[model samples]
Target: MNQPTKKVLSLFSGCGGMDLGFEGGFSVHKANLNPIANFGWIEGPTDSEQVLLKKNRFETVFANDINPDAQTAWTHFFKKSFGYSPTTFRLESVVDIVKRHKAGENILPKNVDVVTGGFPCQDFSLSGKRNGLNSHKDHTGKIIGDEDIPSIETRGQLYCWMKEVIEICQPKVFVAENVKGLVNLGDVKDIIQKDFSATSNDGYLVVSPQVLAAWKFGIPQNRERVIFIGFKRSALTPEALEALSMEDIPKEFDPYPKATHTKPVKKDVPEELSETKLSDILSDLPEPDGVTDLSHRHYSKAKFMGKHCQGQGEISLNGISPTIRAEHHGNIEFRRLNAHNGGKNIKELQAGKPQRRLSLRECARIQTFPDDFEFVIPATGKTRKRWDLSPSQGYKVIGNAVPPFLAYHIARNLEEKWNLFFK
Candidate 1:
């Protein structure tokens, strides 16, 4: 009966990957779980190894990010997995923490209960430059300096400042996220779902914003984003505001998350729900030159601008990678490509293993991050002290994160409908 934790707060929390999927105990890869949703907070070994998971009931307590290598890989992997307190991660700039919490400066945190974000999807990225709300940068991702003048803190309206931090932290669930090309960009997902159902005053209700698909949850990659969520109209429950204002939501009030890995659709699936392949989590990594795990001894020599570029080809250890893009030189792709540029792994080019690229622990294990979460830390003695994160900032905060097993199935579908949608 130890339930009560639920605090959260995140917000563009890069290196924490939706705060390690809402504070769940880590260690993924047993072909990314789901022996038919038997997830009783998982545990160790067997479906062929790895497992663990456990920990949930949320927690984070607050995290931010203007990215100093995402606060040094989220304060060194949350002070080694949840002992946190590196001032609980606040490298500033959610527009200067909402202008220092609107000038009064108690700067947030008071009964928060979930707020999560992903917010800066590079102007609604379709591999960027769509420039939705005309963002020339600001909100600290820089650029706006032509004598500045782009309001509502740009970066395509930072989810309207994550709907003003869910109208000043009144979070009975918030969520946010972006880039499924912000729902085809035209109305910028119906004007950010009508300014997040006019939050605080309109009292919030939101709902219709889905997308998901990180290899349909088991996260082998090919990404996709979109989320949103909302909720707090005086904190739900009138039968969860009529099963979340219906239009389909009644799978026990669906807070979205269902596809626990799919793709091989051929009638009643269940080869442990298929999919999940990029060699089922990098076929037990070992390559990376004498790896003493400085994020697997680093990679990306870059030069392979061919096959109609854009991370120039290669990846497909039996399909599932592609979208891990917070990008870095030659856009980081190949993990083997030599046969005159079309190199399809042919057993790692007859086991010679050369033409590198995807390392930074194979793009943080294809974005499900967790080789004891240490994305490169090499600065050391002789008075030099500077490299706590480089492999180009660990491939840009593991391609701007959020694949902690697709945020642990959206935080285990909101901790399994939080008491049927709040009291």
Candidate 2:
């Protein structure tokens, strides 16, 4: 039987990570897979192994983001992988899109099944200023004019716009993602959840939000994001409605994906599947000698400011990487530090490679974007196309993205029980 594709509308979609994961049909390192939780992906060769994940039952009918570089990267990857027309991705702010939509512009597609958005997270990110709902930047990331008051249009409150899209599209389901720090910032998580539940006169039943750790889903980064899932009450079956309303969701009806890999703990876990190490994913790549792929050829050249500051620490090869920040310049962590800088990865140093920050390719791999998803592009190179995205742009987009591999797990979990949840 042919599985029906769920039409998805993506908002605030930077570089299409969630879109790619939901659509599925991408290659990833073998270490990113679990033997117990097979999603019907094709395994590659034992030597330098990879896994080609089966396409999911979801299709992104529409995608939107304000960032031009994100559009460039997303357009390039989507066109190459799935033959999607550039028109499928709208380069507009959700706020503008929603306002135009409210004004009777046919900007949004009809019959969207799933709505997904990782709304602007910087304000709520622990690594950031923790602005929460009182952000000073407008929807396009520009600072609000001194004359204008910070309102729902501000970056921190952009999820409200995403909520607005949900009200307009009325998808059966909607998934909103944000930085984990939102939970710590004084009832902000509750406020967002409540706002989502209030959609269309309490038309949606929102499950309690949960923070998903990327490392748990085989991503080689210590990234975590809180996810909010809301189901259109009228669209759900009776059992699903009852099950989902419970304080503790029954395992059979839980929408969250099970953890595929385990992190290290003091006590051993049964059948403990070790997490994928950063080294396992990156060991095969030759040093960025400017002769390899476009992503590997360039990296952040920000000098280390020392250990006290963020992004100055060196990544441990044997362990997962620190969270990839949506930052560039001096904020990108070093791939290796020199001896004077408390350097590790002595083997690379001995091999005569220079101390450098993680390359665009390395960061993308850590985020589980396939090797083919080019992040960096030089203005003049054989790999250069019509786009001129700099390394800074690459780092920003990559850091802002949800890990596609982690999104794949969410997609598969939803796909596996779609019928059970919906009418």
User: Which candidate gets the maximum TM-score versus the true structure?
Assistant: 2
Among all windows of ten consecutive residues in candidate 2, which has the lowest summed lDDT? 38-47
User: What would the per-residue lDDT of candidate 2 be over residues 151-179, giving only the tens digit for each residue?
Assistant: 99899999999888899889999998998
lDDT of 2: 0.89
Over 1-423, each residue of candidate 1 has an lDDT whose tens digit, in order, gives: 688888989988988888898888888777777677746767665564577787888989889888888888888889877787888788888888888889988878988888988888887788767878888888888787667666788778877877888888888888888879879988879888988898765488888998988887777778888898888877777999898988997898888888877888688786878788889778888888987887877787878888887889888888788888877868888888898888979887888878878888888877877789987787766757678677887888888888887887888888988988988
- Kindly provide the TM-score of model 2 when superposed on the true structure, using C-alpha atoms: 0.95
Q: Candidate 1: where is the Cα deviation over 4 Å?
A: 1-8, 11-16, 19-70, 73-105, 109-114, 117-168, 174-215, 221-233, 237-239, 242-249, 260-276, 279-316, 319-346, 354-358, 368-383, 386-423
C-alpha positional error of residue 421 in candidate 2 after TM-score superposition, expressed in Å = 0.3
| Model 2 error, position 325 (Å) | 0.6
lDDT of 2 at 168: 86
